[model samples]
Target: MKIVIQRCSRASVTVEGQVTGEIGTGLMVLVGVTQEDTEKDAKFLADKVAGLRIFEDEDGKMNRSVLEIGGKVLSISQFTLYGDARKGRRPSFIAAARPEQAIGLYEAFNEAVKAHGLEVQTGVFGADMQVELVNSGPVTILLDSRE
Candidate 1:
C-alpha cells in the first residue's frame, strides 16, 4: 500500500459533475494498492495518517496531528500511483492491484481511519473522478506499507 497524504485547507472530489466527497482543514489522501497489499497494511497506514503531525502548533512548529486539530480526510483510490514509466513514453500499470483486491483494502483503510474518531470521506472506487484541494503549507508525505 502507498499513500500520498497532503495537508489541505479544503478539498473535494467530483464525479459526473456532482460533488462526491468534500472536506475542510484536513488531509487529502491518494491511496494506492499493490498486489501484495493486505488488511494489515491498510490498518497500519490508517494509524500513521491519523497520527502524523504535519499541521502547525501555536509556536509555528509542525506539532499538531490531524486528529488533534479536528481535521477530516478526503480519500481517493488512485491505482496510477504505481505506474512505471522508466521504460517507455507510456507508463505501465502492472504493479497496481486488481480492482477486486484493491477495493476491499481501500474500504478497510477508510473504516480503520474512521475508527480513530475522525471523519473520513471517500470518492467512489473505480470511478472517473476529479479532485480539487488547497494544499495548506503544501505539506505532503508518502507512506509505504512495505517500508
Candidate 2:
C-alpha cells in the first residue's frame, strides 16, 4: 500500500455531480494498493498518516500531527498512483490491485484512522470522481508501506 498526503485547508470529492465526501482543515490523502499489499500494510500507513507531524506549531516549526490539531481526512482511492509509463507513452496499471482486493484494505485503513478519533471521509472506490482541495502550505508527502 502507498499514500500521498497533502495538508489541506479544505477538500472535497464529487461523483456524477454529487458531493460524496468533504472536509475542512485536514489532510487530502490519495491511497493506492498493489497486488502484494496486505491488511497489515493498510494498518501501518493509517497509523503513519494520522501521526505525521507536518503542521506548524506556535513556535514556527513543523511539530503538530493531524491528530493533535483535530484535523479531518479526505481519503480518496487512486489506483493511478501506481501507473507505470516508463515503457511507452501510455501508462500501465498492472501493478495496481484489483478493486475487489483494494476496497477492503482501503476501508481498513479508513477504519483504523477513524479509530484514532479522527473523522475520515472517502470518495467512492473505483468511481470516476472530481476532487477539489485548498492545499495548506502546499505541503505534500508520500509514503509506502513496504518502506
Candidate 3:
C-alpha cells in the first residue's frame, strides 16, 4: 500500500457534474493498493495517516496531527501510483492491483478512517472524476505500508 498525502484547505470530488464528496481542512489522500496489500496493510496505513503530525500547533510549529485539528479526509483510489515507468515512455501498470481487489481495499481503508473517529469523504471507485483542492501550506507527505 502506498499513499500520497497532501494537506488541503478544502477539496471536492465531482463525478458526471455531480459532487460526490468534499472536505474542509484535512488531508487529500491519493491511496494506492498493490497486489501484495492486505487488510492489515490498510489498517496500518490508516493509523499512520491519522496520527501524522504535519498540522501546525499553537507556536506555529508543525506539531499537530490532523486528528487534533478536527480535520476530515478525502481519499481517492489511485492505481497509477504503482505505475512502473523505468522501461520506456509508456508506463506499465502491471504492478497495480486488479480493480476487484483494489476496490475492496479502498473501501476498507475508508471504513478504517471512519473507525478512527474522523469524518471521511471519498471519490467514486473506477469512475471518471474531477478532483479540486486548495492545497494548504503545500505540505505533503508520501507514505508506504511496506516501509
Candidate 4:
C-alpha cells in the first residue's frame, strides 16, 4: 500500500462533472493498493495516518495529529500510483492489483480509517475524478506499507 497525504484547508472530489466527496480542514489521501496488499496493510496505514503528528501545536510546532485538530480525511483511490515507467516511454501498471481485488482492499482501508473514529470521505473507485484542495502549509507526506 502507498499513499500521498497532503494537509489541506479543504478538499473535494468530482466525478462525471458531479461532486462526489468533499471535506474541510483536513487531509487529502491519494491511496494506492499493490498486488500484495492485504487487510493488515490497510490497518497499519489507517492507524499510522490517524496518529500522524503533522498539524501544528499551540506553540506553532508541528506536534498535533489531524485527530487532535478535529480534521477530516478525503481518501481517493489511485491505482496509477504503482505505474512503473522505469524502462519505457509508457507506464506499466503491473504492480497494481486487479480492480476486483483492489476494490475490497480499498474499501477495507477506508473502513479501517473510519474505525479509528475519524470522519473519512472518499471518491468513486475507478472513476476519473477532478480533485481540488487548498493545501495547508503545503505539508505532504508519503507512506508505504512495504516498509
Candidate 5:
C-alpha cells in the first residue's frame, strides 16, 4: 500500500461533469494498492493519516492533526502510484493490484479513516475522475506500507 497525502484548503472530484466527493480544510489522499496489500495495511495507513501532525497550531507550528482541526478527507483510488517506469518509455502497472482486489482495499481504507471520527469523501473506484484542490501550505507527505 502507498499513499500520497496532500493537505488542502479544499478539494473535489468530478466524474462525467458531475461532482462526486468534496471536502474543505482537509487532506487529499491518493491511495494505491499492490497485490500484497491487505486490510492490515489499509488500517495502518489510515491511522497514520488521521494522526499525522501536519496541520499548524496557533503558534504556527505543524503540531495539529487533521482530526484536531476538524478537517475532512478526500480519498481517491490511484493505481498509477505503483507504475514502474524504470524500464522503457512506457510505465508498467504489474505491481498494482487488480481492480477487483484494489477496490475492496480502497473502500476499506476510507472506512478506516472514517472510523477515526472524521468525515471522509471518496472518488469512484476505476472511474475517470478529475480532481481539484487548493493545496494548503503545499504540505505533502508520501507513505508506503512496505517502508
Candidate 6:
C-alpha cells in the first residue's frame, strides 16, 4: 500500500463533467494498492493519516492533525503510484494490484479512515476523474506500508 497525502484548503473530483466528491479544508489522498496489500495495511495507513500532525497550530508550528482542525479527506484510487519507468521509455504497472482486488482494499481503506470519526469523500473507482485542489502550504507526504 502506498499513499500520497496532500494538505489542501479545498478539493474536488469530477467525472464526466459532474462533480463526484468535494471537500473544504482537508487532505487529498491518492492511494495505491499492490498485490500484497491487505486490510492490515489499510488500517495502518488510516491510523497514520488521521493522526499525522501536518496542520499548523496557533503558533505557526505544524502540530495539529486533521481531526484537531476539523478537516475532511478526499480519497482517490491511484494505481499509477506503482508505475515503474526506471528501465524503459514506457512505464510498467506490474506492481499495481488488479482492479478486482484493489477495489476491495480501497473501500476498506476509506472505511478505516471513517472509523477515525472524520469526514471522508472519494472519487469513483476506475473512472476517469479530474481532481482540483488548493494545496495548503503545498504540504505533501508520502507513505508506504512496506516501509
lDDT of candidate 5 over 1-147, digit per residue (tens): 999999999999999999999999999999999999999999999999999999999999999999999999999999999999999999999999999999999999999999999899988899999999999999999999999
**Measured by C-alpha RMSD in angstroms, how accurate is candidate 3?**
0.7
Segments in model 5 whose C-alpha atoms lie over 4 Å from true places: none
Worst ten in a row by lDDT for model 3: 107-116
Ranking by lDDT: 5, 6, 1, 2, 4, 3
Clashing pairs in 6: none
List per-prediction Cα lDDT, in the order shown.
0.97, 0.95, 0.93, 0.94, 0.97, 0.97
lDDT of candidate 2 over 73-111, digit per residue (tens):
999999999999999899999999999999999999999
Residue pairs with clashing backbones, model 4 = none
Q: 80 in model 6: Cα distance from truth in Å?
A: 0.2
Candidate 2, superposed: residue stretches over 4 Å from native: none
Better of 4 and 5 by lDDT: 5
Candidate 1: stretches off by over 4 Å? none
Q: What C-alpha lDDT, on a 0 to 100 scale, does residue 12 get in candidate 5? A: 100
lDDT of 4 at 48: 82
Instruction: Please list all clashing residue pairs in model 3, or write none if there are none.
Output: none
The positional error of residue 13 in candidate 6, measured at the CA in angstroms, is 0.4
Cα lDDT for residue 50, candidate 6:
97
> Candidate 3 residues 1-147, lDDT tens each?
999999999999999999999999999999998999999999999998899999999999999888999999999988999999999899999988999999999999999988989999999998998999999999989999999
lDDT of 4: 0.94
In candidate 5, the residue pairs with backbone N, CA or C atoms under 3 Å apart (3 or more residues apart, or in different chains) clash, namely: none
Listed per candidate, the RMSD to the true structure in angstroms reads: 0.5, 0.6, 0.7, 0.7, 0.5, 0.5
